[model samples]
Target: MRRMKVEQAAQVIDRPVYKAALIDFLYQLADDELFLGHRDSEWLGLAPDIEEDVAFSSIAQDEVGHATLFYHLLSELGEGKADDLAYSRPAAVRRNARLVERANGDWAYTIVRHLVYDIFEDVRLEALASSSYAPLAHGAVKIRREERYHLLHMETWFTRLGQAGGEAKARVERAVAAVWDDLGDLFSLGVHEAHIVAEGILPVARDELVQRWEARMKPLFEAAQLAWPGAPHPAKEDGRLGQHSADLDALLETMGEVYRIDPHARW
Candidate 1:
């Protein structure tokens, strides 16, 4: 049976398991955006070319803005202020995939990983657009508009690197191999995944999400004439479970440095 829409946060108040599942899913969504946005910002003034530097900076801003939107949704559910939620969480409670926490390697790695993750986000957002939770579905519809441009930007780079061949092709392929390990966790929805799906918060299961992402990548692969890397293998540590790399710790320290000094200070 199709689940009825949850029109508001107050509708979820009496359902503990369902509400918890919803909260966990929101954390994953918010954290991934925050981490990846931070990574993109690191390329500010350091991108391979001036135009690319500006473009990446803009994308970073978009991603962080998206994170703020998700955190705001959490705040509506009584999760606390959006600023504190993004900057104050310990690594153990974060639900983002470890892939986002990784350091941006060379340009090729950044291109490959960002494109790969964007493809996954495309799949995830499509699912969310129809989420039984009405607010989330509406929000996803808004996010997808901006994300389409992001996907286009990354796909352009991914194909450019692949078709360039010679040194460029070699580097992109190597980055693909390196990034595959982290890709495994990209579809995971944490410990509450079953409940989340059961509650119709995401509607799509993990395996289906991965399948859709892989299918979507085919055209890009063909355009670049790149070989399939097969399915991504899971990382040994599960970021969905709050397990994360030291890289995330360093990221939090830096990202929250100012906020920590004065949690109550207006931004």
Candidate 2:
């Protein structure tokens, strides 16, 4: 079946369902990156090594940059100004998965969590790269290019830490379990999934994305000499529907404080 193509913001404006789905979908992408970037940034001064500190800082910048890209798309669709969209939304309105909002626990936890997320992102971008929505497809191509490097970096850490023996291996295994337990509805397409798929804004459904993620992770688990956790359970709270936790509220307060303080400031 051929999906309808939406080439411009003008095109989206005329289609109510597609427009609404796109807006919801963009929020999911933007909010996930915004909070995940903040989490990654917290590692800036805290990573065990100076190299990792610099690396995480760069990754944090990239994630936030990616979020702004999505926010810009939402702004084009009249959601609001990009900065306003990024900084002003309350936690109850956010659409990020729970995984992105969790605190960074240990280096082991961070590495496992990052690798799992990067794989999911890679699978998602691969699907989005072919989206019938032209603007989104173009952006996915560029963003996926950068994300692949991130995946590779996390994979390196995952394997090295796992193979280092004793405490490193134990911690890696423990972190993997913790991350696995937290993986709930991480790839959900939200309430607008059917509309998004019908318009070809996102090519795959949530289930396929999760399946791809699991397939990608299996070998990484084997290479790392760790047991693969089975499929994740559906979360009780659906973040896609704007349900989040206490952590998200605190993170948002900090992320938007500067903007809240000086709404008129250029930056």
Q: Give Cα-based local distance difference scores for all models.
A: 0.92, 0.88
lDDT of 2 by residue, 1-267 (tens): 798877878887778888889989989989888888989999988999999899999999999999989999888888889988888878888899888888888999989988988898899899999898888898999999999889999999999999887999999989988887768857777899888877778888778888888899999988988888789888878888888878888888877888999977995
What does candidate 1's lDDT look like per residue over 40-83, in tens digits? 99999899999999999999999999999999999999999999
TM values, all candidates: 0.98, 0.97
Residue 181 displacement (Å), model 2: 2.4
Clashing pairs in 1: none
Q: What does the lDDT come to for candidate 1?
A: 0.92
Q: What total of clashing residue pairs does each candidate reach? A: 0, 0
